[model samples]
Target: MTEPNGTTPSSDDDQIRKILETLLADDEDITARAVARLHPSIKAASSITRSESRSRLLAEYQQRQADYRRWRRRVAKRSGADTATSLADKDVRIAELEATVQLLTASHLAMLRAIGELGGFSKWAKFYEHHREARDRLAGFGAIPTAPVSSMPAEQGGKKIKR
Candidate 1:
């Protein structure tokens, strides 16, 4: 096309303009159609190149899919093992806590019973005094002496005792 200055556009400009117009068109699917039509050699080479590229991309995609599958399996196995280990550890910890609770409960009940036995402050003081006196007496006397009580089998209908 001639410019307003009366200058004619070059062949290169016309070719570039046509390619640009083709690009701006709605059908972007036509890759180098104009060039392929101008040069038959390039048309064959472009087709071969496109075919090789498509095959290479497909192979890479398949490899990546396989790798992803392996990775997913490994992740799932690790997560499952972690979950199982956590559950086992939790069970052990819970058992340990239950045992501790039982011990604490028994100790608490014993303390409550001991406190209940003391009816009042005076009774508590007397109880302490009685135990203290008995302990001191025992200490002074050394080991406690056992008393023997005799029961005659002839006095009652009873089983015979083996001495």
Candidate 2:
């Protein structure tokens, strides 16, 4: 099969490949419009180069990415075994911190249940919600709001504190 212009597909592909190599050597962008501008004889330059040049660009980009990963691995090795040890230590520290947070959450829930049994949960919830809202409002003013007196223990509870 041949184009109306009498050029065969394989021949057109060969031409496109050669043009792409020239573009690469010149360090210029390998685009259909650029190819057409350089060699107008190749009719429908985009369709001709779509299969040829796209794979070439994709391979180049993949090579660059692989080079970057290899460079990072080399740098990490140069930093020595201490960096690996510190990374392992950080993982352990993170696990310990997560466990501590779980324990604190359980304790907090137990305390809330005890307060609910004493029928003081409603009042506590109201005060807690109001405190959060006040804190958020004060934050916009760049001020740190103090805890309300109602949030204190029964022994320390007193009249409501104004902001």
Candidate 3:
């Protein structure tokens, strides 16, 4: 149907074409309106580009943080392994020292027993004096002393007794 302007709805395309032709005939006003219409679209495109750039920067920062965390974990693991190895080495050394102490203790005990069996410190002193005397006598006369009577032993009560 034709409106009061006498242009039918079916003639919308023709009417728009005519308006565009008239605007083009006078370039200034239509250019201003076209610029106005495009302003928002240009701003929207720039905003989308800025959002994409921000997302890319955030992704890069996250990747760097992940790399740093991985590096820290690796260092911690290495330090832990080193600590374990050091503790193991210390245990081995302590065991070796303990074995050495055991050996020394056994040797010391054997020496004490031997000293006790040889008539103790006072008896050993007396024996040494007699030994020196016998050596002096032999050097002077070219003759050794006979064995002492008390040194002779006999079995008695499941033990030996010196005469």
Best by lDDT: 2
- Order the candidate numbers by lDDT, best to worst: 2, 3, 1
Worst 10 residues of 1 by lDDT: 142-151
- Each candidate: how many clashes? 0, 0, 0
Decoy 2 TM-score against native: 0.35
Residue pairs with backbone atoms closer than 3 Å in model 2 (clashes): none
**Reference-based TM-score of each model:** 0.26, 0.35, 0.29
For all candidates in order, the CA lDDT equals 0.49, 0.61, 0.49
lDDT of 3 at 30: 36
Tell me the lDDT of model 3 at 38: 39
* lDDT measured at residue 16 in model 2 versus the true structure, 0 to 100: 61
lDDT-wise, the better of 1 and 3 is: 3
- Residue 155 of model 1: what lDDT? 27
| Candidate 3 per-residue lDDT over residues 1-163, each given as its tens digit | 6645555533533433344445444442433233223332222223222445433433444465566666667667777878678779999999999788667656754554555555463564466576897546533542322323222345699798865
Stretches > 4 Å off in candidate 3: 1-78, 121-161
RMSD of 3: 41.5
